[model samples]
Target: MPSYFSLLFKQDFSDLKAAGNSWEKLSRKMHDAFDTHRTKVTGPLHANWEGDDAKNALRFLEDIETRVQIVQTEAMAITKVIDTTRHRMEQAQKDLRAVVNDAEAQHFRIDDDGNVRLPKQWEEPQPDESDETRHERQTKEALLQDYQVAINRAVDEALRASGEGQKALAELDGEILDHKNKQMAAESARDADKVMDQLGLKGPKVPDDPKAAAEWWKGLDADQQREYATLYPGRIGAADGLPSDVRDDANRLSMEQELNALQRGDAYAVPGNDDRLHNLQTLKAELDKRDGAPESKQLYLLNHDAGGDGKAVIAMGNPDTADNVAVQVPGTSTTMDSTGGQLTRIGKLQDAAENADSSASTSTVYWLGYDAPEAPLMEAANTDVAGPGRAEDGAQPLRDFTHGLRASHEGERANLTVMGHSYGSTTVGAAASGGEGLDADNIAVVGSPGMTVDRAGQLNTDNVYFGQAPDDGIGWAQGLSLGRGPTHPDWGGTRFETDTSGHSGYWDDGSQSLANQGRIIAGQQPEEYVPPGQHNG
Candidate 1:
């Protein structure tokens, strides 16, 4: 345990931080070495060699690769433990200094021995002290005692941080590397979690507001931020108001962990585990395809879940730096399994926006952050399809997500457009009409049943637009369940033209419907719809 005097005056974490940095660098080098060994050595050897000796040698090389990976993983775990320890100790020091400074500010003195002493004037009593003077002295004495207690508590925290760090470091078995342990990754993750618990590094309580969440994120130091992102990825990844890249890293880690656990049968007892595993695997494969893609084409996993009706939110480009951003909400039957199709639609949307205006950058997002209604059949009799309950339930999450995008964006604010398809339009409508609304510049809905509002004006946005295919039956659902459909003339929103004829065909390649949405997303006015025989062009 660290003593109060040593913690206050003699403790330094610079060496610990330097060691962590070194380990991080070494971990990277080890990973690179493994990659090189596989590519340059084993890859060619397997292609050319054919003897039994070659087979044996290849097996040994594979073992070498596994061992190297284990070492790299262990190194990373060590770095995390060191960084977490440094952060905890530094925080403890900060608390100690604050209380000491506060005590001294009030004319009290703290000695090198960690004792708080009152001012000399308070030490001696006045010969003819009045009742008021005596009472003042007693209050001062109590305050001094409180300061001492605070100082002691801060010291105790430092001692615990040091002890826990020591234990966490000890638990990371170096023998795992020598043995080529296949389970080293899981062990390392468990060790990191233990450190988080022991050091109280679970991070601060985050508020639901995106702006406030961003503020809280910005308040943490680099090390603290790393610990929170690595150790508590589920929370950090789902938190709104964090940078897109930060969320991307955290979510990718969390998804990988969940996938690994499920594959290992560690979570076999979880309900819907098989479906959840399939969804995550499909999502991971899609993201893996864009591993080395361009920034504009890169996929950022903003959020994901393996729970009931698993959720996923992904961006086609870096939302934080894009000039134009569009958030597309999906309707019925969307889940983690729909990742590929939904991502393709957003990619096409991004491409359309860029084609409409090549000079400006655009990022299109597929927001399945809400639990859209799902049922066994697409019949109108299904309550999930005809009812507005799910849409209403998703309102606040959608609002928070859009607000988070706005809060985390850099430079000038992006021209944000929120578009919903099918039942998703109802969710968008519900979100925009309730609370502070989505704060979006434009709201567009395609094949919308209703926006949960009688009029577009109730959505709190002036640039509302609606598109409905000629043969889409979803329009008939308007006013039957949710509010009046946005396509209704009395709804008071712009009616955009759509060349496609079905509810799901609005995004068909080269169609006017897709072009019109691209125009709206690019901050331009879409062409107005006209009756079949009314056009003079």
Candidate 2:
């Protein structure tokens, strides 16, 4: 996974610069503190402590030292660079920012292509001259002396009419803007996060009934997860609830975070910023705030993944292109934040497909807008997810994802390909057989436990593809099984039998699996499949 985050900001770079400076300062302070702490430890005070208390303090101090060392080790870890060569590069960037700021001040845009365009709002409009006006213009032309006559002759009525037409077209361009705005609004939630909160479709659950909290925790909803998190710090933390509430410290630091994120128009973590620490604070804040309030109006958070950062992160891809599109649904231990920002995994897969098919114009999207439940039987017995147990959890989410794709993009897509990894294969199988609004041309599975269908024809999809690595421990352990138990047999599609990449990260590198997937998208039936990440290519 790539570590650097490309935070989009306005032309000024105000937020970027602020975030950079704050990180640099904080890192320096921590470094200084570490040096001082080490010095103190070197003195007699370091060995003064005894028993369990001393051991705990020593462990804490050791962890802090490791962190400081790790930050110093990575090139981009610290916000500031201390190397000799990079200082000049940093200064150059600051200079470039200054120039870009000046360019923005003018009514012009230096686009990604380096071309300049007139600001949309400031462009001149077309004139509308009626017949009477034209006749009055002709009369004025007749009254023209030598100089006026020369001018009128030089600019003919045809030219005048053409100029007016262009001006009118320019004004009509506003209509194009209006139409596009409506279309975007239709696809995207206008104030999505607020809607999600209103629905109580956020975070872990916080049970309404404190008395039935334990049972409610069993079938915990995202809302009740939050309530439990509020009550968590005192309780050793509930299994199906948000973690402890660090309100006293987190609340105080949250103001700084908001100031940097909202005002600066970027997500910024405070002094003690780490993904987990920041997310803990965010969960508390989300739980504390009232649902449906205007404050939680981040559209992306609502429609996409809103569970800040949790233990697991899952990535599902819906591929749609000219030839054949494929959708990949994943199971448990998958959500946006749980994956340590790795949940943005869909983007790389999209890039891979597009890169492979320059002629086909393939596209990929991640649909994460519904709740899928596990089977009652599966839920009763404890089973490790990512195994046969995963098949059970992935059942409903895959179906929901497929339905979301069909409903959201009807005419915009074509030639579907559905592939489910782990439990997602079952979800795909279920969706293809019958669902609210899901359609697929082909289906495939990789690193899967079992898909519930007998054959591709039975599921009503055009084709079905299946893949399992020769060395995949899970595949070898539970091959071709679809029974009620975790090691159930013969549930996957028969068509595809590939292991282009062993188990994970097929698209990341030049692997056989990714290559074959790309070929499927290109609508070709030629050579063997080549996974992008598997090979050095």
Candidate 3:
């Protein structure tokens, strides 16, 4: 019998296949039962019940249904993991067998017992060696070289497969353990601990004030931090006072949970089915694109939601450790479906920021953590999304997000800048005008509909920056419903030259606007904005 490592190229995963198939079937059954319980049992009980006893009975049934759903979801996640492992095992075996088959086809004998012997003709030449005989001899030598190359490649792949096979098994073991733990948890008594103080929960207290929030986060020990991150990932991840690195980790887990639920066709993804699918595909494509970029960049998925009015915040590079961090808030018509394009734009800013100052590391964030107004070009003529309604609703989240960044940041406080484009400027301005103060070193707005305010002084930041293109139609919205565009002199900010690429072209590559924005984020002087002759104006 071969050892497990030696059999890595030949091992079968029939057991995993059977397990996965069983789980897949179980998931389907559970889903059907859950639906039936809702329609046939829960609905009727709720409609007919009036007394306390009936209400208590309904609650018990509902709790059991929730537990069943959790099991079904985990079963599906585990099934995917098992299927991946099975495929990897099959491919590894095929690769090894291909090398053996090729060698045998070339007349190099490979016995079942693993012995390789050259043809006897090489040991004893023909009695009278003719030209044809010599040619045959050379051909045999060439085949031998081919055999050696094939075997070498096969061995390299086999080694890799051996290591990866073990790794996959280890991961599967962890998943299995987690599944069991979840089951046990469902059966056990529920803990009454609230996960975060902000939500009025009992676990850990986080203050509303930015500075106090930082101190509250510092008070938690490693065990307590882990507990909160595990129990209430959504709250801990989105909480303003948590550490960025911790928030990133917690948020990633939360994002994965929500994504898995969505992929299973959960109810939350029902309202905007087409939009939800588009958003998921776009999010995956963007993550894949970033993974392919040169050099390793860490991605922090700070927030994600697939329900009505989607929100997402993706950050490239570790914001907690970086010397400079820039957060970009997109404007009108920016939905989760367009996240890939938004991430690319942020990537450009990240690259530009690095080029601006090689000595400092920069983290660029694409913030879509609020419901942006829908202003599709076809509906632009009559859309209310272009107004300040969405901005007013989004302002508080932006303020909290910014304050959280400040609270959780490490080392010497980083130089933070919040950049808003188009209607996003309105949202940022609203947040700034609320008087809580955004705890940022600078605030920049470009091609703005308005900031919901007239003066830069109201923004609570000394280094307020503004940019605009003369031809951009957003200039017309100034002093109207959207307030005043930041570029307006009365806004009382440093106005800089931008590209002629219309309202949305400010962050395009090789453009003066991007270079200027990069300089400001990199903590460079205002005089350093755009190199000589880079701008049209």
TM-score of each: 0.77, 0.37, 0.59
lDDT of 2 by residue, 453-472 (tens): 45455567656566665554
Report the number of the highest-TM-score candidate: 1
Across residues 1-537, which tens digit of lDDT does each residue of candidate 1 receive? 754665555677789989999987776677567656755676667556788997898767756765565456567767877887788778878888888889889999888867899888998889899999999999999999998898888787777877877887787764554554443444555655665566565655777889999999999987567656665677899999999988987787667656656666663226677887888888876775555456698788899877777788999899999999999999988987788889889988998899888999999999998887886224777897788889989899999999999999999999999999999998999999999999999999999988889999999989999899889978678887788887777989999999998779999999999999999999999999896889938
**Model 1 steric clash total:** 0
Task: Return whichever of 1 and 2 wins on TM-score.
Answer: 1
The candidate 3 region of ten consecutive residues with least summed lDDT is 188-197
Tens-place lDDT per residue, model 3, 1-537, is 763334654566788789878866675566567546654676556556779998789767755555555454444434444555566556756765776777677667754434455677664677789999888887887777666565556555555544544443333221323433432222211111111221233544556665686787678775346545544566777776577667765664455445544555555435666566566556644553443233326567777776555688888887877899998999888987778788888888888888899899998888898888876422457456556777888888888888877766788999999999888888888888885867789898888878888889998889988887777777777777777667665778887767657877887779888888888889874432354558646
> What is the Cα root-mean-square deviation between model 2 and the actual structure?
23.5
Question: Which sequence of candidate numbers ranks them by lDDT, best first?
Answer: 1, 3, 2
**TM-score, predicted candidate 1 vs. hidden true structure:** 0.77
What's the CA error at residue 377 for candidate 3, in Å?
7.7
Candidate 3, residue 388: CA error in Å?
Answer: 1.7
Q: Candidate 1 clashing pairs?
A: none
